[model samples]
Target: MAEILFPALFVLLALGVPVAFAMAISVFVALSFGSSYPSLVVVKEMFTGLDSFPLLAVPFFILAAEIMTGGAVTLAILRLAQSLVGHLKGGLGHANVLSSAMFAGISGSALADAAGPGSMMIKMMEKGGYDRPYAGALTMASAVVGPIIPPSITMIIYAMQDQHVSVGSLFMAGVLPGLLITGLVMAANARVSHLRGYVSGEAMPPLAEILRIAVYAVPALLLILLIVGGIRFGIFTPTEASVIAVFYALVVGMFVYRSLRIRDLPAIILRAALVAGAVLLILGAARAFAWVLIIEGLPQFLAQTIISWDLSPIVFLLAVNLLLLVFGLFMDPLPGVMILVPILAPISLALGIDPNHFAILVIVNLTFGLCTPPVGSLIFVVASTANLRPSALIREMPPFFLALAAALLLITFVPVLSTWLPGVSGF
Candidate 1:
């Protein structure tokens, strides 16, 4: 049954069926003939899968991201980042990375960053005489930070699936690694800029000028703080924080920035609903699949299989990283986390690895998948926005991939990098 389920799903995905549909079909097939499980039980399990309060956090966080994107916040971050970095060689590329790091706080979804920032930055870079494919490739590369920073939708999904892992802790765990990636991007941009003879703006902006823009950007920054701080301080859970985030962004966009209008609300809600619905369906289906795997002792089977090789923790982590990277190549972040986390949770725990650390590692692994070949959503988004081929982006992306791989290795061995801040908060 297990063999049939995964292979059929992959075959369907290979044929270019939508991932959610592929998962649903696979689940149905698994229930029908793979095991002795009743079809009715599968249906019941699917419903129960979504019966989680924390799961509500997914849509609200996604909505907050949408609202923030539609508001002045996106422009303000871009402006501030440009002021700071737009004077250096390949300055615009560096600006893209900085803007993504800043916007990661505001809009937690990488897809949002890729579409919004990638569109604006790619055009600006082209106008500045940077190669279109280069601009597009850079945008796709930096957008990876979106899910690795605070307020991430992926972190919310991780929390919903694993009760023992706190959303707040996962959020904290992402901060340092996210910053490291940003730095790596900036370094790469410097090299590319120097080699390509990229030039900064005619005049460097004054520090006071940069500070003024940052001041105006206070509202968006506050929204991120409100959500993350509220969660860590126990003022609210992830779900409550998400609700607050929506209203906060709405008020800021309307009253403070005046960028959001009444008409925009309907569109925002509709778009958010579409994204939320897709995510929830995937979550529900993955949950059902997870239940079946556990019932059939899949985790134990996997653990025993790994033990048969008599590997070390380093070997095990490396193998898991490779596995996740492959899974990420074919699917989006949420589905990969939903289906695989449960299966590996027991194994990771038995190896004395922190589950929170493991969750961060898994997400980071999956994050790279979004930039890989075939179905990498970020790759596709950046390519389309820049009118470049995925193959083109692939070439420009390998250096950043090296940086990301190095960061992954650091986080894998240095669990304290992921755990210290969360532990300090007593989460």
Candidate 2:
């Protein structure tokens, strides 16, 4: 299985097979050629992967994000972000970063963030005198916060993979780091804006108007507090919180905002269903792929070998960071989490690293991949949404990439950044 599975997986990926299909087919090929086990095991493992109560949050959260987008909650948040930051130097760029952070609270998926609010911000920034590719790159970079913040789909999947970290714990753990990444991206935007002579064209809004916008945006923003607070206080489980989020978003979009209509739900549901289906497919395939590795005892083999190296915790974490960064260059975070968490998480635990800390570090590292070249999904989403070439976006990515790398290092070396909130919150 070891000999046949990895090679087949690589070859298929090199052939441009989708990650989900590639993993599933690799499992089928490995089972048939390298073991007496029937191919039925592959199907069984894939189905088994999707069998969890907590997993229900995946689609519900996705639907909530879709509903919010269709209902104009996203636009409200963007307005609030703009009112707060749009008066600063490089105003539109700051607004882009701020909106991505605010939107990340509602939309757990990075691609959704990039396509929805991110696309809008790109257009706004370009109109405000920023370069098109630069705006797209900033949007792509800032949107990585979607998965690092609370209500994260990646963290949900990650919590499922590693039991030591609960959804609530991970949610609390993510707050500061998410803010850290947001600040770093904003700083990068400031530097670029300075160099390019990007200046604010609009004056700061009057206090009364800022207050009104905040008041209007509060309902949408409360959804974040609702989810995180509900889970932290045990008012609801993360799965239940997700369901409540859908209803809450519906009410806010329809009643308060009057942006959502009954007629609009079908299309929203279809889009959410498609996104959810794709995510689950990758998870299922990754399960089968990881199952093949477990059967081959590769995890144990590698764990034993690494444990024998007598590496310090700091050294081990730095090494894992490097490995994950490289791995992320090729894979999306979801599948990357599914396949690698089972292998690397146990090793981190053995090294006495805190689970929540390790989990956030891995998650943050993989999200960077979403904005990276070769397989950066956010790059493509932003590019297509903004009508810019991917190469153009990539060319503008270095400063933002350096910022993200700096954030990753902070999360890696300073476990306190990831663990403290969870600890204080009683997670």
Best prediction by TM-score: 2
Model 2, range 234-299, lDDT digits (tens) per residue?
A: 999999999999999999898999998999999999999999999999999999999988889998
The reply for model 1, stretches above 4 Å from the true place, is 36-42, 307-310
Tens digit per residue, CA lDDT, model 1, 1-427: 7787888789989999888778777878887887777777766777898888888888998898888887377788888888888888888898898988888998787888889866888888889988887788788878888999998888888877677788899998888888877888788778887888888764778889988988988887788789878988889888899999999989989998899999888999999999999888887777776777777788778878866787777888989998998889898888888888877776777777887888889988998888888899898788777788888888887667777787788888888878887888777
Q: State the weakest 10-residue window (summed lDDT) of model 1.
A: 284-293
Angstrom error of the Cα, residue 164, model 2: value is 1.1
C-alpha positional error of residue 380 in candidate 2 after TM-score superposition, expressed in Å: 1.2
Superposed Cα deviation of residue 157, candidate 1 (Å):
1.9
The lDDT for every candidate, in the order shown, is 0.83, 0.91
Candidate 2, which ten residues in sequence have the lowest lDDT sum?
Answer: 68-77
Model 2: number of clashes?
A: 0
TM-score of predicted structure 1: 0.95
